[model samples]
Target: MARYVKISSLGPAPCVIEAGGSAEEAVERMIAHWKRMLGFVLPDKPDLIVMPEACDRPSKAHYPKEERLEYYRVRGNRIRDYFASVAAEHGCYIVYPTHMQAEDGSWRNTAQFIDRQGKLMGAYHKNHLVPAEYDANGILYGKDAPIFECDFGRVAAAICFDLNFDELRLQYVRAKPDLIVFPSMYHGALMQNYWAYSCRSHFVGAVAGLPSSVLNPLGETVAQSTNYYPYITATVNMDCAVLHIDENGRQFAAIKRKYGPKVKIHDPGLLGSVLISSEADDLSVRDIIAEYGLEPLDDYFNRSLAHRCAPGHMEP
Candidate 1:
């Protein structure tokens, strides 16, 4: 069956905080900014909404160590509560990214996932962090990669710096989550598209001061936020599979001939692969692949690897 999900990725520039403002006042101002940002997309009724990393961080403000700690102390959980309320009221899942202090006094750059009912489903503490995050900011590196289960599909998260590391990306490739949500301050360039194609999952990136985008499994940008609009809402089908064109070309034609408009064979050109998505309620991508005996891209690669290592195989 078609597992369609509407997603909204917001990329508004970081909220500005007055250098001399009180922490309470700063929190209120940040909340108001986010409320206005969310207002622009809420009417689309997105199943999931993603915000940029450190969504509540102040822009163009320099705070001393003592002042930063005091600000975090005063801002504790207020922004989180407001996000939960919005998720509850809107009945949609939200990815809220921020810096959170642990019980032991250390902090983690985290992305918390809120369920449709406004409950805390799970949080992905950033596994990779820049040197400044630990040396100057006193933030600790996370060790685990957890996949959150939502009504729509399996979801995973990667913070800004996390996009550059293959260690984390390899784990996600093994887990094979349907979607990878990236909340970042950095744009990550081609790494974003690489991760989507390598993991064979749809990728949504919400970057502060950059274009937020939704990419298909083939690493093709399906939708993106433009200069005029800081947020973009797009609907994508999660019921899809990536297959190599090597042995699947005939099968692709056969499936398309049979299903016609009920399936989509998207060729991103020069990739030697296609993304097949089911658009019919009675069929799924898996079913179509089974019916057509199509080989998945990874499986095809694995098979080739085994053949290359065989005893009689020719040397490269």
Candidate 2:
């Protein structure tokens, strides 16, 4: 059984994540919560660590995108070092996912996951960024989903915004990872529905996206909390779920085939690979990337806000 823990917690300090606050203090708070929530720290310190978005206070936007990106990169490294030191102290591998950061000055948003040895393991750049933010332009928006390797098993990540797109999840699924973690900022009743639907619909065994609660590989609600700030954990056994396949080496599913004659649902899950062919002309490569861009990442960021504002585009 694979153990996946999801926690709904608060930031360490008021201004650390925002700017002009102590990042060390924020990390300390996060560590304390981890120890208290998980009962005991990892023996090998687990291969991957998953964390919610924006846990740290962000820096003010006076600096240009390049400078801002550098600032976050440096700060992210510091924060990871802090977490890694703790993971090493306790003995476990960690894949910490924080708010997206852009390095190389190319305007790409990324999720950095480090291992127990305090080495940068792998990163998942936001192929799908939120549109409103200025950083959504150029190299940041058009990209593919990449999964990282870990000691326990292959792992992939879904940012808070990535979770809403079945396409992103389908892309991660193609990686055939043993686990997929989503670190999000959403809560309340709506999250309640997503929590349940994500398990039953998306991940067959591994947790869908992390939030206040966690679901098991079997899509079962293993644990939850009544408090406003909550954390939950469950063990995942990768060998459990079967990856459906046909004789032609194609995974089989008909959900999209069942759509209306003019509309087709592309089940990226049934087919391996983030880029898949579909009969649906409406769904294009650009559309997929636009929906999942990283820098401006948000749950509903990709939806057509423009069309909604202009009623003329609405069909009768």
Candidate 3:
């Protein structure tokens, strides 16, 4: 069972708005800018599209704090609605990141999940915020890490500053979502690969003015946007697992001999762990593991821990 999902990450620089422009004009310009960016990937027919954090905010505009708040009030959910329409039209999931005012009169730095039907599935608010967000701005910190279930797989999100905190990362590690979508103003660099490997999930990052990338469970870059191109699309198979090579070397060879080209055993060199994915239509990674009696990397580590902590083996 190969669950292949095509994803596109757009990393265009933030759209610019005039300092004295009306909110209505500003919203129109933002939409137009995004529309042009979307034109690059919609032709690829991606299953999901991810944009950068604070995507609707203007780049170089210098508006007073009060005026900016007023602009957001007037702009409202119009830009979100436009994105929803595009999602429905293209029949793809979208991660729309922005600053939104809540019903309680508090604002949140949010990444909203828009389903293929032009409906909002859920949102992951920024769990970790910088002091400036709380001090200069009135944005409240998000309290929970929620996983959204899409047609393809379970999804989670992390905003710009949220990547630095272990509190949010630990939650995602325990839950183990299939994919983590990161929409950020700042690139997390090695942290992106670390998060993907730690959680054993695929990572897609859309960072403004930087390279947007798609990495596999092995933390290997499958696709990336470059300076010449601001957008990139890559397809990933969700039906995969990671296993230690120490005990599974023979089993890996046997699987390859049996399944041949239908299975992929990817070794990222010195890690001593390999990512196994199924390419056949009839068998899944779980089926192959069960058939071959392979131990997952995490399970092996946990079992070793239990053995070390046994009553007879425990040290005084």
Candidate 4:
């Protein structure tokens, strides 16, 4: 079986890059900790990897078009160059997203999946951009959710807020991905609740990647070491359990019936808002316990499902 690694990481901003430590430092930290902590118990080296968004610190010098493309071109190239170098050194695959401008002025947060040989295997551009990212009118929003294929399994990306949309996730799920990755930069007072909700609800037996940090009003904890700031990288095995199919063919009717009233559900809009909505897949929680034993899967599910999401529209 091809082994895969899901990376949940906090992004390194342009400021971090200027202070003697570039975004490469954050990548190194994630790689080092991933190997040191998770790799210690793994049977073999991971064959594929996934990372959160904003891997490249986008700046005018590096991200502008025409006169600016040159700057962004060089910086963008660094992201790939570094991954290739590290993949060669570690003998592992690395997947990440870069800021790419489409024909128009808008940006496409394109996810690039690379093999251990440093070859570019697949790419997917983000389709959902938040309204807060827009100007006064709230007209601009991202518009695509593409899934890609890899040697190990099918790979797909849902940048941060994208996971909040059930319709989008379901569209990806219907395709039956072996692994789905979500990289988010969600930071707010209630993020603790939101992050927990997203990981537990949408991701089952499938890894949900995150790299988050809390910025204090005061600069008190800003300079703390790795101990003060940490990230979560969880590995979920998709092949271990099966979805429950009732005699009448109701897969997950119990949970659906329970939460249907409270949670507004809808289809991903083809011509409406970018926020997608739908029900989570019909995964068998009991069967997961039976196969993997109740300890791990139970603990994971019991974590909670209260991640904060924006208001979703009802199905038309």
Best by lDDT: 1
lDDT of 4 by residue, 1-316 (tens): 1132333333333212222334445445434543543333223445544444655443333333343344454454655776676666666667666666555656666677777777777666656666654453232455665656655456556665665667666676455554455555553324333332232222311112223432111111111113333343333322222211222123234534654632222212231211111223443333423433333322333432322232453333
The predicted structure with the larger lDDT, 1 or 4, is: 1
RMSD of each: 1.3, 14.1, 1.2, 13.4
Residue-wise lDDT of candidate 1 within 1-316, one digit each (tens)?
8999999999988876767768788788888999999999999999999999989878745544565567888989888899999999999999999999999989999999999888998899999999899998889999999999999999999999999999999999999999999999999989999999999999999999899999999898999998999999999999999999997997777787889999999988999999989999999988898888889999999999999989979766
State the number of backbone clashes in model 3.
1
In model 1, which range of ten residues has the least summed lDDT? 60-69
Model 2 TM-score on a 0 to 1 scale: 0.53
> Model 1 — TM-score against the truth?
0.97
Q: Which parts of model 4 have CA positions greater than 4 angstroms off?
A: 1-15, 18-44, 58-73, 102-106, 132-144, 187-236, 245-316
Clashes of each: 0, 35, 1, 14
- When summed lDDT is taken over every stretch of 10 residues in candidate 4, the lowest stretch is 216-225
- State TM-scores per candidate: 0.97, 0.53, 0.97, 0.50
* Candidate order by decreasing lDDT: 1, 3, 2, 4
